[model samples]
Target: MSSARTTPGASHHEDAVGTAADGSGLLTYASLVDGKNVPSDQWVYVVDSDALLQDAFSSLTLKRKLESGRLSPEELPGGSIVGRVARADRETVLQAVEAASRATVEWNAFPLDERLDRFGALLHRRLTEQADRTIEILLREGHPLALARWQVSGALECFSPESLAFYRSQMLHESRHGERRISVRRRPDGVVCLNPPQNAPLSSALLGVTSLMAGNSLVVRAPRSAPLGVMYVLHEIVAPVLEELGAPGGTLNVVCGDPAPMLSAWLDSPLVDDIMYFGSSEAGIRFQERCVAAGKKPILELAGNDTVVVWKDADLEYAAEALTESFYGSGQLCMIPNQVLVHPDVVDRLTALLAEKAADVRGGSVRQEDVLLTPVLRNEKFFACLEDALSSGAELVCGGHAIQDDGTRDTAGIFLEPTVVLVRGLEGARKVQAVRHETFFPLLPVIAAEPAPDAVLLDRFVDFVNSNPYGLRNSVWAGDPEVVEHFVTRITQGGLLKVNDSHIGFLPGLPTHGGTGLTGGVYGEANYPVLRTSHIQGVSISDGGIRPREAVFGAWQAMRGEDGTAAAGA
Candidate 1:
């Protein structure tokens, strides 16, 4: 038996376009639109399903046929599609949005404990039975097994009941202002449309849990290229829990389609009150503007160009180990140490250790646990940046070439040599292309900066890191307490700052997404999703909470629906 099923509007050519019972072939994953699985072949007419279908087809000849509208019965491809995915039509999208809007009202009305309990059950399932299933789907999607497990585990911890409670308290709380009693209430912003990036499959759901907890109905559009893992987690793991708890059909709607059209729907529809977008800086800015124009809120998680600083008194070995994470996931991660600023005194030894570590990175299939570096799509961009760095007074200390095979893997995946480039000095690094932009590759640029007096060096490093356009996270390795304190107090660039600790991986209680400049948006602030998607309204309940002169207080009370003729202070 095959895993894929024919839904409405489907035209199946053969059994090859699905996962086999033995788990030998591709899984033509389906979209969950309004709590129902809609297959890719069954996409409605409003969607350009044929175009999407062609993208997944294994044969180039078949792709051309489908593209030119010349695909005949005899010309239909026989082989399985490698990246089969479902694309939702306009009708389905609108239906999901409408259902979400309806569900939002009921969800908000549910008792707080009941809502929390439902989520509690979800967490329990995710950590137990769904744990292995989630990891398998993640592995099938090309994520390393260890990374897949870590992502699932971390996300589970983040959405735990205790974590949610802590986040809620931070977002909203009640207090007394002088003699007046005030209660702060956070209201849902209605339907939130989540558009997560393809790089990290779990980000959408990880963030979406916050909105759901805050009583907002969600319409999450899974990335078309990597929808299987997301769909598996949602449909297989979370959906069952939702059903068991008798959640409304629209309470958590998910769909997959061409991102351009889905983004258009989010911007055009008034039903979507908020759009949580994760992508490049340019596109995120444009989307932010569109959302603002449409009277909707946009929570933007843009690009990151995190940097690390190594002081003279630091442990060079530990620093090298931490810096090696920059090549993890082929440097596709947002928070990995992309650039490092080392003191000239320890620059030589540190660079040597770092180069040796980078060379040891194993390159293999992305699904493999030992393979820390995976194939990157933007080879031209990576090479161009590498060339620019070499030409601009930067010496290639370790790797400077692309390797088809690392003598370990037989897979046909593009592999870039784990590269480490040494810059002449901090001034020279400023001119290097790799230093100018966030190079999302397995390339790290090391700059040697001459340290000044203790106070002066601390200020210089802080300013230097702050000047970088991208700022998701930054870290420093130093033994001096005063130096660490100075770095922490003076640095106002990245959202997260680590002192002599591993820079990768996020904890459950800390702010997960935040930064300044490019890493964050125009109004860059620490992202607390539940708080960002909500507004705080102050309410005062008393017999006479407002007491003022007749000219102003009387009018205010009358406007507030209180009797104007009531006695003073009453």
Candidate 2:
């Protein structure tokens, strides 16, 4: 909880939130687990001569710190542990940053493959060496083991050979017409602000590292809710790799606490080129708007209310497994299926199987195989929202009960049984609802449609999922080759779509990240993680090159030129 600080700059009073920090300045919140050692988050504003000047200085200081490795250390509330970084004085950050700018140039020029290999090695080592401890921190931090596994394992896979394969697939190109050979490089912006969710720590670091390996500097502004967990993963596992790999010091900077101001600062600063964020769509959208206003590229893995379309041809048991994964993290992920599109023919059968499976899923304390991350249920807020939707006519099929089990009803012990709500057709109060928009909490609403082999239902479902305001992930549980094909063709066009598979099964190097349009600026699966980080520069040395189409006219545009050769465009 200690750091050197000089004269601080602009500051502003914090806005009121639910929880408050203790006298020791420790952050305290009503987390999924109460009485835990997790710190309460603190918010501060950079003070300046004027409000606009504060923003201007905040942006300036953010850039200097990002360029230099001299990050302001964040301390947890109570001063027992460090939670978020403190903002250093403007002069101090600027002076420290001056040294790091040189490293970015060198890091960027090194061959991409060589740098990727270095990170790939880091992933390998982190997996083998830090496996046990990594798992422990994630569990203690509130993520269920099942969810933690994805976070840790996803990092390993992100820089693995598979990811390399995906990058290869994306980076190469074949010429279509006349000597215009091309390749698309997923360039890294100078520095990226990756704000990961509390539910995922390792996955967030992997997101930043994958982009860094793609040749960009990075600054991770982790969520204040569980910043320490992510900080551990980054500082312990990823940062060591960057050091060993000869990457610039600021290749990836880590910070926790309120991200709004840092995000605003980064967006407004020239040193930071991109912002990678993960959270509710509303928050992500706000970040995107600010980034756009600042002319920064944003890669938002925003909210999702994904739907799994199950056809009568599908194996009910397999579809059930997929359903389990969709809600594995208590349906907090953007990829988790928020609803099910069950054909009427198999509704009764699949419904029965799902109910049985749901009943059997182990509950209570988070265990190794624990698939569910019991949400910090909103209680009265949850029920009130449910009632509003139900009274508006959405059917409550089963299990909306709060934990009536005396064994598990504490202030911080938030748990909700897997929910199953049924909505008829596409509209009514159920249609175009929040349930239809994004995955939040562990609620699954099934939209049952008339039985038919026609792919029309799935097509309509795809449109509904993709056309909605936000885009991240969508999936299908059908075995029909035709359905699978359609799902692959249509869904992959978005972020990471799966077929007869779990919605959250993301492999390294695969474009299993980033989304389109409403989600954020041009980024997805973080697929653009590497591609978007670097800018494109075309180079050609033709062994035998240059051939242009001679127009119908004898002289043509080329001959008309003074040099008897047309400009490339001409």
**Per-residue lDDT tens digits of candidate 2, residues 187-281?**
54565557776666457666666666666666665565555455556555665666666666655555554556655556656666677777666
The global C-alpha lDDT for each of the candidates, from Candidate 1 onward, is 0.71, 0.57
TM-scores for all candidates: the values are: 0.84, 0.75
- Write the residue-wise lDDT of candidate 1 on 15-125 in tens digits: 332353334254555666666665444321111222232232334455445434565323444432333455778887888888889888888776655555556546555
- Give the C-alpha lDDT of model 2: 0.57
List the RMSD of every prediction in angstroms.
6.7, 11.1
